[model samples]
Target: MSKRTTPVVAGEKAGSKRTKAEEPGIRILGPEEFAVLVADLLPTT
Candidate 1:
């Protein structure tokens, strides 16, 4: 069996610091791109 690791939560850590350019977990997708993503995920016969 493989060992499991804890998933880290997003946000700045205690005593940690961030700069103006340090942004995480941000994404923007248009409708057409989202539709393509959904289509790729669908199971094929």
Candidate 2:
């Protein structure tokens, strides 16, 4: 599948410290939370 991206204008920023799923006011996750993310991404493990 082709990954489509928005066209950033000149002088605009693209990267973020957090990923697309993370929202504001949320503390950085601990190991258990990160593990859940990994499990969710797996293919029917």
Candidate 3:
């Protein structure tokens, strides 16, 4: 029988810190803004 080894997953390290450039941008949209954005994608039928 062969020995089985566990594989390490990416981004599973403890206490990992991301640099400014590596961080993702977050945006907070108002109710009106969100509705407008959704309306643009939806078809008018």
Cα lDDT for residue 5, model 3? 20
lDDT per residue for candidate 2 within 1-45, as digits (tens), equals 012422212212323533331333334455566677778999994
All candidates: CA RMSD in angstroms? 10.5, 11.1, 14.7
What is model 1's C-alpha RMSD?
Answer: 10.5
**Candidate 1 lDDT score relative to the true structure:** 0.41
Q: Per-residue CA lDDT of candidate 1, range 1-45, in tens? A: 112322222244312322222235233344566677779999999
lDDT of 2 at 4: 40
Against the reference, the lDDT scores of all candidates come to 0.41, 0.42, 0.40
Model 3: residues with Cα > 4 Å off, grouped in runs: 1-25
What range of 10 consecutive residues in model 2 has the weakest lDDT sum?
1-10
- Stretches of candidate 1 off by over 4 Å are 1-25
* Clash number by candidate, in order: 0, 0, 0
The most accurate candidate by TM-score is: 3
Per-candidate TM vs. native? 0.41, 0.37, 0.42
Give the poorly placed runs of model 2, Cα more than 4 Å off: 1-27
